[model samples]
Target: MEEGICYLTLNRPQRLNAMDPSLLEGLLEGLQGAAAEGARVVAIEGVGRAFSAGADLVEFYRA
Candidate 1:
């Protein structure tokens, strides 16, 4: 927490931080946790070149 802000970093730089089910779940949980912890602001960042490549189509197509 920095200056009442919470930062959530997407860790999968190898895949350009693709949004798989696990990642989505973790994001949701992280947001909830941040809110519960009384964070005034939330910041989402990604590692590597892209912030996100959006949803993982491989996982989507598999469903």
Candidate 2:
């Protein structure tokens, strides 16, 4: 968080930032934190080749 801007980074580069339960939870937490801190903007980004590869099929199957 900086200058009222909250940055939520998806750091699962190995899996192309797949949306797993943990990651989703983290994002939700980040959003809540940003709101609590009065952030005017929330910027979500990824840390690797792609922003997101969608859901994690392997993890989904394991569930």
Best by lDDT: 2
lDDT of 1: 0.94
Tens-digit lDDT track for model 2 on 1-63?
889999999999999999998998999999999999999999999998999999999988898
What TM value does model 2 have? 0.92
Report RMSD (Å) for each prediction in the order shown. Answer: 0.9, 0.9
**Which parts of model 1 are misplaced by more than 4 Å?**
none
Clashes of 1: 0
lDDT scores for all predictions? 0.94, 0.95
